[model samples]
Target: MSEFLNVNEIKEKVSLLNLLNKLGFAAQKVSGSEHFFLSMLREEYTASLCVNDKLGVWYDHGAAGVSGIKSGSIIDFGLAYWYPASFPEVLKKIVEYAGVPLEKSHDIPAVYAERKTALKSSTYQINSISETITNPAINAYLNMRGIGSVAAGHLYELHYSILDSKNKSRNYFASGWPNENGGWEVRNKYFKGCLGHKGMSFLQGAANRLAVFEGFYDFMSWKVENPKDPASTLILNSLSFLQSAKARAKQFASIEIYFDHDRAGMLGSEEFAADVAGSVDCAFKYEGFKDYNEKLTAGLSASKKSLDKPMIFSAENGFGR
Candidate 1:
């Protein structure tokens, strides 16, 4: 039998699991064909995906109108809508989405710990990745002081092996937190950070108060803003990490979430509020922009526990990282 392309390869061709994974969407099983969509309405996740290994038919329960696609085709729609302009390596992310086998992967380089990098690596790749971080957009993203700033700090690039679209051997640099057991949640390009309460990101004083942020940039920015507000902080990194992190964070009497203000952030914030509503002394919302970094870039003020109302931390006056 001829060998089939692996998960990374399949993601390049389409975004079945990739799309769902990125959006934190769950797949719903259908009768004939296999297809899935991120359903905000779905109650449970794994249950949503209908993977009939026997018959490759996937269907999404929450989606309406048109129907049916293999994981790859699903990615086609996901990227087209979510990441228009489709960064060069995005298609490969799609392949990784489908769980297909990829040619290679990458790991961190040894030369990093001694440097305060002013420049960014050209691209980042994953071990078993089917693409490289060489996309012009990715290159430019690497150049951004924002992405590079993190690079020079706690985050490092994993210079793992990979197979580019040409199927040639190559290495990719994926951004990862310095600590072990930390998973990832990327914001703007080249900016990778972890969201879980894993590691010491939640180190806080004895006060029950806590600060929550959605991405690394914003988390860094919050510290820049609240230089004097000595409290515990948690960076969900991505909206996806909030739920699990919430369960772990309940130990504190108050948890203030400074998540991104985008649709995803808002959704996660609501869930967070619901999760810790009565249990915690307070659950605050950052009235910042769609994202903390953006709001800080736009010049917002740093503050904690707004006296004007309950849990509204506004960055309207201008803040910085």
Candidate 2:
């Protein structure tokens, strides 16, 4: 019998890199394979942090001090793991996530554990983020986009914290990965595989068109572009998830992958296409944008901004002629 793990089932043993990989992140390649750092940092590319799914030990090409440890501490510290109330009710959240028999949920006691933190001597609060998000820095970020104070405050409440992922308390923001119905944004939470339902039905009958991208955000961008003739979109959250999406592609008469124009995106898409050539009728390809988000950042049509941001256009690196 397979022993099921609850939210409290010794997460330290849960291999952090493996879990992060499951959640759709890869080793930051910007460091040129020198150290196994999370790809969350804004950089070009780095695969130094390779996950031996079985062992979970990470090594960098150059950065020496980091030895691979089981990911429990990493999850707790990297993701700001506290008691349930701080975020959503984590017990319910985990049960909804793990799907390991909800009846057994009450048996787990640690979910009720209270977190105690030492007060900081700086201008920021450690966890009571409901207050700290309104500072000038955060507000300035919100103001440029014309986000309402209340909505910005809400997003801040969830993501407005200084997370110390690689050691320094860097102020960061994050959100979602909470449900099976994918959204524009989600957190890296799925540990074993895709967090939600794995198998999606192909569009049968005359409409055999296909669409695939790295995630929901890109999917939405395509939808916005071809509202009348957009094909079904697939979410390849990370290259690792591409395998699962490949399996799902079999159901479609034809499939098209809109992977990023970057190296990893092309590699992952091409690999998937090669593997599924026998099953899928047609596996299309398109990689001209960094992502649909990048397309949106590029102002989509020389005149559009992310919806929440009131600015109709932006000057992101790739945007504008």
Candidate 3:
């Protein structure tokens, strides 16, 4: 008779990466000892599940953490695989797979026992935040991009940094927007990354109808364009936030999506429209441009160039000649 085996026994003995490989989940991407895969349970374009071979842990970022599971041990993964299965059944299946005897035990692995962190928070530290845009580089960057002072005023000047795979340090000082996970989506001319958790940034105003933007810059540009008619807004820092945005869109009577004029944006808009009955895609207004900000910046740059041109009057160049 196959005896029962503890969760720890499975985790300590079973190699998750190897098991995944054997099970035909070849890693889609690898960084150092961590392997990323495009999730076995769902259809997605990007790899979300991360298996850390060094720490002997796996993190499934599928569903933007809405699944309520991120990092876990092999047994926990088994439970996700055989969802709604009894613990005894899960244990038995693992035992049969790993060729481990079902020795009765109550001990679960420490890795699986670790407390789950709030999925929304990210891994970056926010050293400082200010209402004023004091950094000259940031100011120039924003102004050059045609993001007005009104939009800049609402943004926080953030001091933050992110570490690479080798644990190397790269710091940045940029304008930041706070996401639902309390992470700062930091951006400057030179760098772009998140500090803390990653999710959508929702700003509540008048209800019923809401405006959605793919990036904070577009949201701010929208604000600059329509300061008086401020309504509820959702800033999806990335298309990855599309699901979370969809969930949030339910509370509003209608939604206006302002995504880029790209293939991903078109697909995302279609999905959003399908999910929300009254959702409107406002991208057509800025057609032929990548985004609203691009149009705004291009218009501003063209005006500046026109003004910079010297007044040269000749027979060929007729200006009321």
Candidate 4:
């Protein structure tokens, strides 16, 4: 077997829920990291597949339990889902989707704790936030995304430096959006990450209805299109804040969600709608585009084409480690 098929390596790094999402399996419901999905291998009125995102494992109670195999790693789940596909083929496909196996570190929980610690001890610091769009790279980035200067003003220029896994310091200058926890979600042509606490950012307005977006760029795109729309805006910098958004929704009369059209996004929209009464999925406006930014950049002509492609990550080569 190839090194990519290393069972322990794949089990440690790849998120089963993310894998299922990338494979076009939308969860019927998500609670915390546990995603309940209708089994892809069999037809059923109810969901029997559950994936634990935190553990990178899954359980198909209906099928696996019949054989006294109650649970398994992502590899096992993939083998069952892909049916006649040989073990090698399924493993290869998983490796491609998940990127190279991550280097062995501490256990999942320990590593998670360390990541939180690293975030708290970040060497990066936000020097300032300017309304000006002076950086050519940032300005070009916005232009490429079809975000105008006026809309760009909503984002700030961030200055920070981070040490990579090798402990080498590197500086960065990117567009930043401030979240509620006073952290910055930094983005540029080459990088995407957060600098502080990860949470939602809201723009206070007089409207009783709130417009929820998956990212600040999407919110900016919506602003470019509906500058006068007075609906209060909420941008979940990440989907983990969806529950928090649901709780916040009680304060408003209704909410209009504009999430991406990907499997995760579509499934999250469903869960969000189920949690918040009078919530409307507004993603239909984008139609075939992946997200609002994509719709903006691709234009009407591109919308005619399909965006149903596998989820590709920057870490696909060797960055996953």
Expressed as tens digits, the lDDT of each residue in 1-321 for candidate 1 is 433234334434444444455544443335555443333221222344343323323443433211111122343343222222223344455555555555644421233211112111222244532223444554455444234433344444444543344546564455444322233333335433322212224545657777776556666666555656867777553343454467756777777776655565566667777877533322132353566556555542223223334454558855322
Regarding TM-score, does 2 or 4 come out ahead?
Answer: 4
Ranking by TM-score: 3, 4, 1, 2
lDDT measured at residue 98 in model 2 versus the true structure, 0 to 100: 32
Between candidates 1 and 2, the TM-score winner: 1
**lDDT tens per residue, model 4, 172-230:** 89988887755677889997766643457999985698999988999988888998889
Of the two candidates 1 and 2, the one with more favorable lDDT, higher being better, is 1
Candidate that beats the other on lDDT, 1 or 3, i.e. the better one: 3
User: Which prediction has the highest TM-score against the true structure?
Assistant: 3
Q: What TM-score, computed on C-alpha atoms, does each candidate reach?
A: 0.44, 0.41, 0.65, 0.58
Which has the higher lDDT value, candidate number 2 or candidate number 3?
Answer: 3
- The local lDDT score (0 to 100) that residue 98 gets in candidate 3 is 61
For residues 3-36, what per-residue lDDT tens digits would candidate 3 score against the true structure?
A: 4567666677778886775443567579999998
lDDT of each: 0.44, 0.41, 0.71, 0.70
Q: Residue 277 deviation, candidate 2, in Å? A: 2.9
RMSD of each: 15.0, 12.3, 10.4, 18.0
lDDT for predicted candidate 2 compared with the true structure: 0.41
Candidate 4 accuracy as TM-score:
0.58
